[model samples]
Target: MKKSLLMLNAILLLTAVSCKKSTEGGNTGIIKTDSSTTIVTDKNGKVDSLSESSTIVDVNGKKYEKTDFVYKATDGTLVKVIFKNDPKESTVAITSNKKTFTLPKVESKGGETVYKKDDMTARVKGDSLHLEQGNNIIELKRTKI
Candidate 1:
């Protein structure tokens, strides 16, 4: 009985130590496999893989709403966030050029998909979105709805 109790105690102690150590590890933000193209934010919320996939998440590491999508644009092309409020109204908002652009309109296409001669292409697959312009590419990964 004593031997068994000692073993149990040792196991419990080891488990507690391991758990504490694991939880104490650094909290690095999001990560991407394609280092050359993807860029994860310092808060681990947004990531751009540049290859063809990107991810976006909230401060809590939860993904943003809407499916992943990509867009290519020429240098100096200022992208404005437009709301597809019916086919006639869309608001424009200036955002940081993080390479990976987030879309507020989850279902807005604006009648066209590709922008010709823009030196940029937006690609969407599953929960990953990528935007490529010239040699610059941005990826955003969606973690939530």
Candidate 2:
């Protein structure tokens, strides 16, 4: 009887220690990825912004500037846009629904930028992004830098 009581007491003590409440706070604001992307989140676990800025080197030892932006659709879909700019050429890549499409920069004026590939068009102005393919259009608001 004494042995069984001792065993029961040990089990209860272990359970109590394991279920002890934490005194620490919740997550901080920022999280960084291995690819140099930074994601900022609120205390409620909502994402605020994501940004990636890095330098890429080509085969000929030429360096190019690369920047990334993340946007959220009205229906909560996410799209990621990447821009690579060099003296000779510039391109924009958009990823949505697990598909990535790369487009060459067509025009930039008055704080608006446009990219085109085949019949698809993408436009960026201020904090919004507009994408058009055939008669279908998708609009997203900037969620990160």
Candidate 3:
């Protein structure tokens, strides 16, 4: 009887050990927040995080959303454009090569938005960015990243 009981216990122990849950490919080091923030890390302590916030601004007595766009020029230059629309006024900040230029919204009609500062004018239409400064015109394509 003792020998049979010992064999049964050994079999139960083996079954329990074999039925253990797997921890591979699970959310071991991922963090999320309510404000659309996500952080991912691996066992080696390398972390990658992204956070985006929803911003609403009132422009011309109407609500508009603040947005950002990144465009790449033909020469591989990157330009960052941030739009802040307020009920009273709208503006855009264009940054490239460590320089930033803030321009006021001069026109927004027919699916095209135009911002101007001094002799520089930027026009955004769909996924394309057109910049004009004096006699030079630079065209940029929108980047998804």
- Per-candidate TM-scores read 0.26, 0.61, 0.57
How many pairs of residues collide in model 1?
A: 23
Q: What residue runs in model 2 are displaced by over 4 Å at the alpha carbon? A: 1-50, 56-59
RMSD each, Å? 19.1, 17.2, 22.2
Kindly indicate the candidate among 2 and 3 with the higher TM-score.
2
Residues 24-46, model 3: lDDT tens digits: 65552332212332243334556
Write one digit per residue (lDDT tens) for candidate 2, span 17-43.
995443364332222112344344444
Alpha-carbon deviation at 85 in model 2, angstroms = 0.5
Off by over 4 Å in 3: 1-54, 57-64
TM-score of 3: 0.57
Q: By TM-score, who's the top model here?
A: 2
Give candidate 1's TM-score. 0.26
Give all candidates' CA lDDT scores.
0.37, 0.70, 0.67
Question: Per-residue error at 22 for model 1, in Å?
Answer: 50
